[model samples]
Target: MSNVVNFLTAGVFGGTTLLALKSGVGCGLSGLRRRETLFLAFVYALTALIIGAIAGSIPVNATEQVVGLGVVMHLIIGLALVYFGIRTKKAWLSDRKDISRRTFLLMSLPCPACLAATFLSCLVFTSTTGVSGVAAGGVIGGVFFAGIAGGGAATSWITRKAGMDNPSTLGNVMLFLGLFYLLCLLLVPAYLQAQDAPAFGIATDPSGMLLALVLMTALIVFGALADRIRHTAERGGR
Candidate 1:
């Protein structure tokens, strides 16, 4: 039950899941066909699975090294998110064109948060359940990714139903969400480290997790508010 909870939580809040939501909104706004949207979602899931399998193969003895590498990777992802946000904002202000499907698909592939979540889910499950081996890891990975896909599909459906299919609106939302996601990637690890929590896998410190979640939510709100203010100022200037 704990493992199930962890898997579900990770999938819901993972960066990849967020990316999927963005993808869905972008697809709806861009007038992408249903087949194309599904194809992109499938690509995300497949990439996550591959990342999970590779991360799981790391030996337990190398756990410290993995954590260090994860921190570095998270930093890199954070920067990528910032760059993406800036680009999206620029595109919105200039051409107002929708992002390309190819670019979206590629971005989904390297989602560090999703990769970390899936890897940690597998690690925690195996550690707790006495399930050791590549096969067990693969099963856990599948389960984690299944949750991600479900969340992605649900968000996409909701956005489509809500008629949020405008390119400029979608672009603005993506830019803000990207910044929020970047904040999460950069801060969560540092928070855990400060708490002296477990080096890898899920931190046992509930307070730390709660704090991270709260901070992430706050970041999202901040991003949204900032975007609103910027738009208001622009309109006033005009």
Candidate 2:
């Protein structure tokens, strides 16, 4: 059912982000290459399916339950990345002179914003009345975060490999882009619901999805730009 779809979407987005971050992808607008992008997307979607199913089966209500759970999941993942990045800073320092303790705080900034938005949406919605509602909400929330995580990972991987002093900036910025999309989800639905809306109408709203797409496109573009910048800097140094 819809729950199944939501689960799948969540798994894809979340899984892809983690995988890409762990393994450096590539940079350049052309770097993702059509083949690599498709492959990574497929991998993310499949992983999302497995994880989403397991996460969905925890005897939770569709309302505040799923939303709350999703927030916790996102927060945990975001924090973990910050931690890993912090731990790796020293190791990367010899290569990146500008890497500093403050970078840790910068990396951690997106979590709270995302966490708050997720929690607020659940509370504001205040109703998980049926399977349909649950599925709809889940997809919106799941895809939004997945986009954040996945996109962040993709951008980060590209930047890091491009040898930018602050390659993670790409990922971190993309993560915030995801967070903003989440905020849109929170506010848009509430606005519609308050105005006495139909579930179907809200379901079709493209803002969240569109935002994600735009972000993904931008990340690719920026990745390409970052590569050029790195190349130029290296030449200038010589």
TM-score of each: 0.58, 0.30
lDDT of 2 by residue, 1-238 (tens): 6686566545544543443333222222223344444454444344433333344343445544555565565545544544444333323433554333333333323344333333333333222323333443354345444453455456556565877535344344434534544454556665776688774255444686577658856864785577678778988999
Report model 1's TM-score to 2 decimal places.
0.58
Q: Put down candidate 1 lDDT per residue, 58-155, tens digits, no spaces.
A: 88776666556666776565556445645555565656755644334323453554455556655655555555545444564444344434544664
Q: How many residue pairs clash in each candidate at the backbone level?
A: 0, 6
Alpha-carbon lDDT, every model? 0.56, 0.45
Tell me how far the alpha carbon of residue 105 in candidate 2 is from the true structure, in angstroms, after superposition. 19
Top lDDT hit:
1
Distance from true position, residue 2, model 2, in Å?
A: 21
* C-alpha root-mean-square deviation, each candidate: 6.7, 12.3
Question: How does model 2 score by TM-score?
Answer: 0.30
